[model samples]
Target: MAGGVAAAVLGAIGGAGAYAYAGEVPRGTSVLGVDIGGKNRSDAIAALHAGLAKQAGKLGNPVAVRLGDRAAEVTPADIDLGVDVEATVTVAIEASPNPIGRLLGSRTVEPVVTLDEGKLHDLLGTALGKDARAMKQPSITFSGTTPKPNYPQPGRGLDAARSADAVRSGWLGGGPVDVPIVEIHPATTKEDVDKLVAEFARPAVSAPVTVTTERGDVTVAPAAIAKSLRLVADKAGRIEPALDAKKLRAALSTPLGAVEVQPKDARVAIVSGKPRVTEGTEGRQVDVTALATDLLAVLPKSDERTVTGKLVAAKPATTAADVAKLGIKERVSTFTTKFTGGLGAPRSQNIVQIAKDVDGTLVKPGAVFSLNGHTGERGYRQGYRDAPVILDGKLVPGVGGGTSQFTTTLFNAAYYAGLEDVHHKPHSYYFDRYPAVIESTIFWPDLDMKFRNNTEYGVVIDTSWTDNSITVSMYSTKVWDSVSTEYSPRRNITSPKVIKLPKGPTCIATNGIPGFTQDAFRVFKKDGKVVEREKFTWTYSAEPRFTCG
Candidate 1:
């Protein structure tokens, strides 16, 4: 009975012990759980600290966590827990039956863990926030002293602060920091301002002053004086001062003497000595002499007081009376008879008188006198010859036929005198009596022979007639050189032809006369050498004859 009671007691004790051991397990603690195994608050805190420490080490810096009003700092040193927390099952035995064969039950209890999460977060936040604060309010200092003559002193202080802010912002974990910039005024010391003034200022330049004697003026530039003084000016100052009267006087005064200033429009007049006369023709001579005196009074003279004059006379006029007295007498006397069987015999004195009157009118040198001007219109009542004269290619009696002889003679005289023949003509056909290329025939105004006095001296023509002959002579100033004419041989001649005509009278007419051409040349010679040779071609047309019945 007692053994049964003892067994019951032992079984009840064993059941109670089992129930107590099962109740000892942690409510929220687990081997692999939410917080990674911690039974108490302290252990959990310790584990969190260890985890954060490891994380801080891997991050290489403090970890910062912002709280409501403050930041928490976590660092490797604050959170590093070197202790290991491990659970083990230990059984406390009161008694054992066999030392080697004892069966014992065990119970597990978690080991104590320690963490410093608050300290770790506080340290990290402090360190990192301090760095951020330092970056926000950066400090800058200048070691060098301020320069003298600080024209822009305030700018230097601001520039130094800006440089420091730039460096601070460039660092990692650093941001734009608000820095208080203060200006430090260095002690002012005097420096030779001349060099600085010279550096910044402009030097003066001077313009040259000109004094002109001809224009009678003097000019001075204030800039020139400023240049001489080596003056310099600032941006707002004048480059140079204006020229005062005193300065002007000082500049002008010299050993040479002050420059004279004349009126702006000053002028001077100068006069010369008596006039001079020059050689000229009568009227021209008088006018030239007058001009000389007038010009002399107006011209400027340097020295002499005397002036000279000259006079020249024009050529004299030669009249018929003068030519008649030239002592040239007619050596040959000749007569040309114009007789027709039917025409009544006119008094021969009528033609003779016409020639005589014409001879009274003398032609002077270089004179071109027209026959019409000297001879009135020819009429029978006027004592002109009614004798047969060629009119419009028919036989008509008029005052002139033989008058042409007078012109021919005068032409020859002019030619011999070495005058320039201006106009002349030849007969329609060749005439046997006249020299080839030397003959000159005339018919009043139609065929006129005119010559110019090419020689510098004057000439006179003399004419006279007798009952049987007429003669003409030319008198001129003695020529230093002799003149002569030469003729070229005839050329381009055509044979003449004979023809019979049926007019009232039976007379044989030549159909064609031989054509012959020649050139006449006048050779002007001085001192036996030919100076000039003038040529004139005389073309002869074929002469035709008519046989009349």
Candidate 2:
């Protein structure tokens, strides 16, 4: 027919240029619709890698596209479509029923991607920096410590900014920090043990050491230890070795001694068992070692001793050759005269004619006698001073008013010789011709009379007088054998008043005579039994009869 119809139009233009060099997609091209028409480029790149691996499995990753200015990693093996690349494209569209009218004529395509944008920004910065490091959050620190500060533990801490930055970064650990140390710990309380025992106690000061000793002698009384430490004496507190001068020279040579006075020598004729009278005088032999060297030159010498002496003995003297050496025998008396009743007459010489003129002798055995050596002062020219005188009661001009009745008849012959009355006085009133207890009296220096030969046997007194008879006789060694008297016939009698005279011769009657009362007794014997019996009483008043003009 016209050359067979022009070879059928050149094989149909060589099959449409082999479907555009094999990257085909024309028969009802609906790629994801299961219709890749002539499907060349390796089956249209295997259907565009199964349609982008189903859109990259629903876009789970790898997919950036925009080619031209570069940006392409379309994974799924880079959508080869069998590699005809060159900005690949193939199309022959159909299927328009609104699938976007079949993808709008479909064929506008390119995909030969290969990209590494710095490894995709290092895999998206290492997968978004590993998901921003797994969304992090953790932090919290701080450290400081010091500990153990002994004693009262004075290392304070309350976390002072973490112990001052742990003492400037010197580190310690365990976070919640707080440290500071130094330890000791002991003093509990009582003011912290009195400030730790006042920093270790000890204060009783004042010491001057020096205490030498092998044991013994220690006198530390420095003012009693300075008044027991209250201090003073220059704050005293230090004595030693100053006062034992050999124990103060043995305590001043031992003191404490005195009290002495011994004397002995009393032999009044063996206490008067007597009969004495020995005459032997002659004694004058003193030289007693030159009087003990002149009394040791007036005593005192032991280094001129301060006080302490000895030399006793001095008491002895009673001579008349010590009473004729005690052998006994001496008597002499015989001078008599009589004439009672005349001599200025006053009722014919009364007072019993002056108790018959003085007569004396009687004192023996260990005797020491003297009454001016036995009476002998009767002067008035030896005529008895103005004779009859009793003055204040009548008769005047007195001289010794009847010489105390011649000492009351020689004290009744020395109390009938048994004497020992060493001193006597009686007559402040009552006076019955004297004899009231063997009366005796005188007043020359205010009355006096004494006796003492207390019979150990020795007495002799024979004296006689006459102006009207007076006699006194006594001789002993007969120590009483018989002597008698007994009288008790007077009772409570008082009368004789009249004493009113401020200056007038008022009721002047100076005791002349009136009241009277009596009682008397005396009996002494030895070999005849009845050894002693003595008693006497005489009370008389009523003698007030005065008249003075």
Candidate 3:
């Protein structure tokens, strides 16, 4: 009998919970001064819409905002500032959940309002633009041959943060809101500008300055000084004057060119099938940094406008002693790729141009060399002619078309040299001109081939080409006794699709080639033992058959 009584009590509690969840909203609930108590979800939403509509009619009009003495009007709809009716109703329903609490509780919810602070800030800036002025700091810059001075000025602007809060709280109340306007002061004042101009700028451009170095003396004209001079205001409002080192160096180079001796870097060349090192020479040049400092010290002087700059010894980037220690004594690896075009052909010209740039490049030990980084952009500006290049599986006339052949040659040379392959991407489609899966394609700034000389010895890249073939050779201490490649049989073969198009300059008709996936392994041997083995794989897309109508 006790178990039966407990079961009846539990059933009554569950019924009460379900009725409360699905029943009308909690009693005596209100939002934005609108009574929505004891109503269903739909009825509550309808009541909120009807009641808020009347309130919006009064408050939705253009609101007047005052910033300092300036006044502007903004409509609530223009800034997306208004109350959300459905959201307000949702808050009311979720306020009281317990059945007993819903029966006895009375709650008031803040209305759900929407306001885009960013939009309101921008509106305030534009509306009160006359009253908003940015503080101008003192500065001096050149205007043609004369130095121009800009004086500092105090300003005033609307404080967007406090003003946004005011609009949020009072805009809905349907009254004119007063936005706070704050005064802005420049870090520097007009007095600083006047002092800088009088003591530095005026005298700096009055006469030519003479820089005496160990090599000789060079006179910089007054006009040159005006162009290279820079006067800027610091955070503490102090005016600072400085000479642009790069600009001054360029301006003084020609006049001092004869007296200055440029440094020469050591070079490596192949002589009698062996690497030969040429000694570098040290040269003397003007010390621009010290000259600038010295010039600043005497620039304001009326009579002593000459400054003596200490001549510092300029060393070559690579000295002969440095190159002699690099252990580049013999040819370590060499690779060649064949091309069919004649010397006058655009493709052949591009291939030769790239080979010229790649020739005589020295890769330091543990340094990664990138083809794109070294050669830069290969466009018409770089003298690369337009030739047939593969694009979207079709051959189109493009610049730097034949440079990829050179890239393939260089990749094979670096591969056999026992260097670490940092990054290399193969062509999307297979071409019979290049070795199946072992070749790489290159584009300006994007696709590239890179290799790192991981050995302790440096490697020198030497390139040579004939009308029909290009060869790349690397000279270094041979770490790998022998390097060879093993190939895996092609798989996942797919036939090309036949694509017909109208005959146009953009289309190049071709017989399609089959695509397949293949892998190549590079084995490095030292003392007749396998030291390292690297695996490379690529999947070639089937070249579509193009038939021009």
Which candidate leads in TM-score?
3
Candidates' lDDT values, in order? 0.42, 0.39, 0.84
Candidate 3 Cα lDDT to native: 0.84
Question: Model 3 clash pairs?
Answer: none
lDDT per residue as tens, model 3, 337-361: 8888589999999999999988878
* C-alpha lDDT of candidate 1 relative to the true structure: 0.42
What TM-score against the true fold does each predicted structure earn? 0.35, 0.23, 0.56
Of the candidates numbered 1 and 2, which has the greater TM-score value? Answer: 1
**Backbone clashes under 3 angstroms, per model:** 26, 26, 0
Q: Which predicted model would earn the best lDDT? A: 3
lDDT per residue (tens digit) for residues 128-240 in model 2 = 22222221111111111111111222221122233233322321121221223222222232353333223211111122111122222123222222222211111111111
Instruction: List, residue by residue over 467-500, the lDDT tens digit for candidate 1.
Output: 5445555554545376677988999896655544
